[model samples]
Target chain A: MPAICFIFLPIKYYYVRTHDEGVAVNKLNKFPKMLTRMRDGFLLNIGFAVLSIAIFLVIWYGLSIFLDTAYLPTPVEVWDALVDSFNTPDPSLGVTMWDSIMASLKRFVIGFVLALAIAVPIGLIMGFSKFAGMIGKPIVEVFRPIPPIAWVPFLFVVTGMIWGPILAIFIGVLFPVLSNVIFGVKSVEPQLIDAARTQGASKSDLFAKVVFPYTIPYMMTGIRIGLGIGWMCIVAAEMIGARGGGVGIYILTQANIGRYDYMFAGMVVIAALGLLTVEAASYVERRVSKWMGA
Target chain B: MNRSVLITIIVAVLLIGAGGAYVLLSSDDDGENKTYDVRVGYLAGDLHQVARVVASDDDVNGGESLFKENGLNISTPFAAGYANGGSVMDAFAADDIDIGFLGSPPAILKSLNLKIDIIIVAMVNSEGSSVVVKDGIDNFTDLKGKTIATPGVSSIQHLFLLELAAANGMNVKLDGTDGDDDTVFYVQVAPKDMQAAMDTNQVQAAIAWEPYGSQMILSGAGELLLWSGDVWPDHPCCVIAVSRSFAETNPDTVEMFLKAFIQANEMIDGAFDAGSGETYDRIITLATEFSGTNETVVLSSMEHMDLDYQIGDNFETYLEDYTQSYIDLGLIPGSKLADRDYANVTEYVEDLVQVQYLEAVD
Candidate 1:
């Protein structure tokens, strides 16, 4: 049975991929070069994501069926569970998959934004001034190694249950933004700085026109990385002790109570979030980079 | 402009990185710290009372100070909190906690592996769990091959569910632990998420203890399948434990804590004035503060739960049974703890449990 499922999925994915390819080929012959290029690039990116997902599911589903263990759910089971969770209203609490997703996204955005606001200025300073970087870099490095989960109790007690998740997510998101901004600032060429300086530009003018424009590309890169870290940190931050309302809280709660479908559903929401967030961030990054001509 | 600028930048980055590393590293290791403070870790559930008392209440502290004039300094290492018992054990190994409460399975597994000098201060609860099945499901036979959720793999619920599997003729195996081929399916989820999971139909069944089990039953997500406490009568679920070295050094503090915990348990168990406004107020506050449920719900739910401090035959027998289950689950090697005197943890527990303080205060 496991073997049959294994054989079935790849064949299905292969057919999907080929059908996409055939469509792409048909369009390519008629469309202009630039339009065709854009179409293929978009199709290829979507294809990679789907193919990866399909292959992973095939392997996971097959192994679970083979092992026959309760510990590991097959891909089909997880998918089915995901659907079941969305369709059923939780009997105990009114929390649905949508609720968990929204709660998590809200937390992620707040933390990520706070981190961005703080990390960018400090990183820009570190990049421009040798002295500031020297003083700040060591502090950033020390905190980076500590896992965000480690701080759950501290933030919970200090801030109480209300703001603990935000505090944790802030820590999780802070470091990446700082590091990336520093790299971005440093990457701007000396020639650009020299040209601006030669033009009698003031300190602010030089930074605003020369350094800032060049570094936006790097800033976007940092945002992308920071957002990913912040997203993953949702689980730890939402450890809300007993007042759990976030997706991580939702997942753990569901899992404990043997609500496999809801657990899977929560996981799917998180996964979709990661994918959606990364894509959105990436799109903004491309547009910004293009505008900056970096 | 030449060598000094480059050197300064390099030194600054290195210095900041080193400082960050120091903060992370020092937070983990406490074995060498000479400060004679009792760092206690507890699962956040019932310990809110203790936390409130520790931070504010004068009588509890004053009564406790009779044993030792030195007031204890308390610092919570929030990172290694009471969620997963493993986190507490990690802190213990690092010398962060003097006393802590952990679920039974993890406590047993750690005891077997580390040979760490720790003793069971007392068992927290000595009752089996209630198996919660989704609404409309009836009896254990209806659960054959159904997906279920238990706590962490080494938890008491984990062991009992496996025992349930074995009794029902399905061989459930722990991940990376056994070669057994049980057709039963179960996923391990934390207790807090069970309600949300049920609401979403993520699992068909779950095994929960006390307040949570009661919560599920009340919420209508599940109906009670044989309550384990009813089935096995006093199966141990949680244990309060202390680091041996820490306990020896901070004997007075240990006794004070034990007294307070026992008092809290008794207060929870003793029949209150059925009509006094204070009776319901405290229960509601605790339920809201700890469990996030309204007072009316917790006040009603408290009727079914037996929250007491008595150490009885059930604690001893369940310890043996649970420890064996840990061994069978391959969470702990049988050889590691085959010789420990389970029947007489009393000798170890006596020095740590200051019954005198509780007796004096009561």
Candidate 2:
């Protein structure tokens, strides 16, 4: 028991020393680091963003005046529309702006999550094994270049209107996630694999511990990209194929009826939803990959 | 800078300079030869054959030279073709189009929304729309629980479908759900793709304006479940709509344009009355040329449509009823000036139909 303690004590001491150094350094850096972050982080960036948006609004207002067409509804008019849409339901569309946004978000989440579930495993298999990669390469290469809208008719025929847009979005998101996961797996450090093997780690254990951790940052990147593409795809698919209520459908329907103000409001809602989702994805990445020091 | 970079910069500058010179010279030419540009929006279907004949200078009645004869130096009219009435209304709102030949519901919707202040100039065609279904589906009740496609929610055909369903006591569900046992699911499809959707069994029935409905019947993809005229006899389908701004700014031009269109409509009527031979052949040729459809489809579609240019009392009643249907559907607000009620809605519809131009032409 003493001998065992002696052996374990050195290892424990080494860990403690490294951990203490890390903690001390973090403590020493915290104040200046926070100051630097404050100089460049949320408040400052938000201020700049607000300024940028103000400039955009000014330009838009100027153009609206210059054009003087009903199509170019002013910011004030759009605001009125946005307010009205939120307050009262559009009888034609059968829903308020809030309902449309919620419906769109629900479809987006289902499609995005479905894409991730299917793509991640296939990407992992392709990345970790040469045989799988060889088989998947041609299939991915072929389908990756096809635009999501091209699948609308086929999806509509098979799944009907309700699921067609979601499936279209899933297809749009799948390729980006798959490609990035494959890249992350293929780019895993050779030395790390050798080290794990030298320590008598099994193939499954190496994949579970090393490959997964290494691939997570890349997977997050893929997810971020997939999410953007998925948002665009959801809008287009819904515009073309959705029979029910969605933000894209609302925009299209409004435009069809010459309600440009409502169309612009719907567009603003889509942009805000997209920005929030991307930020959510980034937040998840930061939380999950904190050990990578991102 | 490196020699290669310097060379590249010089080449880029020369290219941009050449392109700029070309654009400047071309714009100067355009400015010098500026003709009265009347951008007209019309549907890509046989309903707008009169407008097409006037624009294309192939009027069988020899009305092509009428623009110059009226002291208007109009060039070949710019045709802004759209797939449906809704898009034509959109173009009118955007000021991309000054005149439109579109369906009644979209025209009325736009006027009610104050999107485009348009005057209903003339009737383009009537009774050209139909509800077509797969061969085995015989009646409106048989369409229950089956999917049906229409051009849009605010389309005249859609309104017709709703009325038909209501008459037959069938529930029409627009929500994206599969309808219940007594409900018919309604999907909005572009008129161009309605036949394809029907062919693929994606939709059991399609309610669309001609020549799509006619095309479906000609192709044997579907049979006519009900003609719109059979539902509402001589129901107003398409109307000639002119921007109020255009009419106010250029009343003579609008009058001249309407005169030419009315003449073409007369020619079409004369040919239909004659019913065969050279006059009818010429009308079919003009329609086929403008609509980008084949001759057989054009001929068959014309059989279902009455190319009447007059907007009579029947038109006013039709417009009022249609406006009330849209108001009840919660499509357009009930009224712009008063409370959301039938009287107010009728008042609003009255304001929308400006028939002084049509009357003056008459």
Candidate 3:
């Protein structure tokens, strides 16, 4: 069977097997209608995305012609440059475009995953305990406003070039994820927790069952925002200094050498990576939401 | 949409359209006899003292007044600064400034890339830079697998480092990463922070221009591994460059500017020749004032540098060698050499060096 049909078959079998005789007929009929609505929605979204991208390209092409400078390369030139970079290692930088992208992605993922791992647990504790909240709140507020670029020099001194950029990204993503996760935990309905406690649930059970599921959506929201911040931080951090070739370093080296087309190509790759990762995060969010029926 | 909102949007669009049109139209005002603000950039190093002396309007010690005396109405100068030559060219590429006092490597690289149409007008100074390493690291061979910092990848000091490494048969890598254990690593640290990086043991050594290198030695943070002059005697370091458009439009003004620069160079030479009097004191004072460095550092750095006032035969040789070094380092395309042999590279280097203004000055 086709994949789409296979997906629907399980739903049909489960409802048909579980529902009462009268409800079974109604549910079986409703499933196809719901599936049709979902397919249409997916198509409509794809259509809008394509239309928006086409408009953006048209505007970019118009501007490039109007500017008429080497600095402002046309879309076609940038595309050619992108293709050329992917195919060949730029002799000046000693790395291909794919290598640069992979290097940047590695740093971004490591830093972001590390930030999420540390921030979520601290946020949970801060939300659950008043003493923890009081102690952590001031530190976060004080450090959060300082820009990530400012930390480059200090981090370079402490971590060296290889790990400095990674740590800088981690610092950039930490606060937003932490604060939002705290907000997620605090916003959990108190009545739900009280009810769980009344049902003979222990503290750990109440947290696992009641608090955790309620906070997952908010935690996802934090991760989404943190991912964006981490991307921005990695670029700036790499520009300050990098040992291996990264997208940011590649763009900067190209700019310094007056290869504006390749610079733009690097920028496009970074944007694409950012979009791809955010889409992946959204996919995970949707799967979890479905599991929780949220 | 509502009628009021529609009208407001139309007005905003018209305003933005008009503003952009004005910018586009006004850019053409750089015609004959049209005076525009002159933005001059200089590195924050002692090598740029000649340009600094010329740009300043301080009556007691300013080069702007001297230019004014020669009937060149140089509008009050706009000063742009960078820590090193690499960033100076970056500013030029961005159109942040029209003229720069920067090192030869960056100037050559910028012209090769055609980012800015620039002509080297005059030589600044030479032999002022050095390679300094932490104490107990006695020689270039000791730097294997150790980290060293320079102003930037394309700065002349970086070229000097690479040339030295190549001479010693040492493998050098520009990226500051964990590479082969036998390779040396180089990172870009701004000149101002080179001392700090050395002091904090962030880098075991640094190749930098004065007075940062001098500061490091004075503070006991490092010892001189090699003088730049020891590698290439009287090698060209910083040169004054002007955008080709600026030179074309304001030929007479540029000539006058070069005349003033030559005069300042002469004055510096005369002071150093006197070797210990009011004249030397004045040069040191002016250098300290412009460089924002202490008097002792400036004095010590001056001892190491020879300020060349003229564009000489050696400049062509230096330019060719530097360009070849760039090609060898893979910072520029080797195809620049594919069509040409050594003589052609010399001719190409000569094409970039416009000496008419400097020659016309005398």
Candidate 4:
């Protein structure tokens, strides 16, 4: 995928031809009006998102007030809790919400990078070789259906650390990348390979120049999808040992202690974190695809 | 143009998200675990009668007046009830109780996890615990290579068996294996299916506290192996633990609680004359209030009267023994605390108990 990304990306740029080259001239001609239009669009989205948040908070508050039993503390009570949590001079141990977030992120990144490292090469090998495909296909099929959580104990027993949960994320992500790499490799036009051969390119060169280029986008797509799934698996992964202070642990601990407020808080934090991750991933996808002219 | 700026933005967002998550995950709450207007957990069979009595009693500080002060609708006591000590322990861990009654084993296990701060306000009863074994197994060692059923891995019954095994040089593995030839099979099974487990020869013996133990004995299915209290005399069977901060912030309220409990204990022990009209009414009311037995049956249930309501001074001995058993079982770290620390449990207990409360009531 990396070779293909290096190869086809140039081909994409050759056709791209600087679509935005005339932007400065166009901006000068209608700069004020165009800027205002873009500004309006941004403001409109901001308003809609704000309204959506306000509506959610109102509904949540109403439900909480109507169910003012301790089992269902009102949003006001939760808000007060949130405020009280911050008001203390030094946020005590376990009160470190930032620490939990960083821990989860660190685990997620390590698992993600490790998955990519293992999956991409295996995927490339399986895509190009019949023997690799035949041997790997059955194994992938058998393990893919076994949920990431099933690997948690295996990971724990092996690493004797919190890495078990992280490994679960890696395993979950690997299958998607494997399947996508195979699809991407197969999708490379055979004529391009033949052309490369006719042009005195070596077998390796043909593969490097023609096949690799077509597969890069597919591998990227797989990565995006796999990472989404990996994040979901992280919570199950963090359940293995005592040092497990991930977002999932946070939620479960609150649920166990019947602290619904903290549980809700943890859940909300996860959602927000997920949104931020997706946004960053989307930005990278857009930038990469644009640079590749794909 | 500015990659560092983008990186900074990403890092900042991540830190904020991470910070929120850490606070959500790590917030240590040792106090204010009271999540309900009235979080009340007790024996399932006893709740209805107790609710009626509390609904009627005006003298008890947080009984009837508690409901009134909280403006709780008195249509029915919304108290949740469970049949087993394990479930109550789970509920307690979940903060599903402002106050609840839990068996000694669950309470002891809970004490290991420092944040819980469960204080035994009073001893509920002692003789209700019994272990039953197969009819042919005349002695404890006779049931080698056979499985014994327990409700949970850490129930009082379960721990009693563990304590017994440790004393007798047996390894209580999860699968009920003793490395040597002599083995007593011990495994956890759901409480409801215990009788069936026994009947079908799935389990060779069962260690259960009443009313399951008493009920099993009555059925003539098994012979008694040992009463758990006899395993460790005056072992503080079932206990009533209130939140430490609840006791601290509301000391007078706690004292009032002790008064009510002591009065009930005195009445149940028959120290007060039930023949007197006032005493008889209170007795009938209490029998109706706490146990939910019919006034006649509840009064009769107290016939084998040994209400040892005193909280023993041998706190260190129980803690050391209990913590050591957990350590030996590999349930907790052996080096978690020292002898002095166990002796001065008052670090946690002082926040929960005002011995003066019990003494004053006495």
Best by DockQ: 2
What candidate 3 gets wrong by more than 4 Å, as runs, is A1-40, A58-66, A84-87, B1-37, B45-47, B54-80, B83-87, B90-96, B176-182, B271-286, B289-292, B328-330, B334-343
Question: In order, what DockQ does each candidate have?
Answer: 0.02, 0.29, 0.27, 0.02
Instruction: Give the better candidate number (1 or 3) by DockQ.
Output: 3
Chain B TM-score of predicted candidate 3 relative to the true chain B: 0.81
Tens-digit lDDT track for model 4 on A1-294? 343333344445433434556545544446445435644775545555676676777898887778543445566666665454344311111234565676688888888899989988888888887899999889988987887878776665555334666788888788888789988887878787778888999878876777777778788888878877887888776544313256665555444333456556666777777777767777787777887787
Off by over 4 Å in 4: A1-47, A71-95, A242-244, B1-362
Model 3: clashing residue pairs? none
Model 1 lDDT tens row, B156-228: 6767787777787776531111233444455445676676656656567888655667677788878888777
What lDDT does candidate 4 reach at residue B207? 80
iRMS values for every prediction: 14.6, 2.7, 2.9, 12.7
Candidate 1 local lDDT, residue A82: 80
**lDDT for each residue of candidate 1 in A1-294, tens digit (9 for 90 to 100):** 344443354556545655675566645444345434634676545555666777788888888889664336677767876876667544323345666566667767777888888988998999888999999889888998898778876676566434667778888778877888888889888888888899899999988888878788888887888777777777866644323256786676554433444566677788888878888999999999888765
Task: Tell me model 2's lDDT, rounded to 2 decimals.
Answer: 0.78
Superposed on all Cα atoms, the candidates' RMSDs to the truth, in angstroms, are 18.2, 11.0, 9.1, 19.2
Ten-residue segment with the worst summed lDDT in candidate 3 chain A?
A1-10
TM-scores, in order shown?
0.48, 0.78, 0.81, 0.45
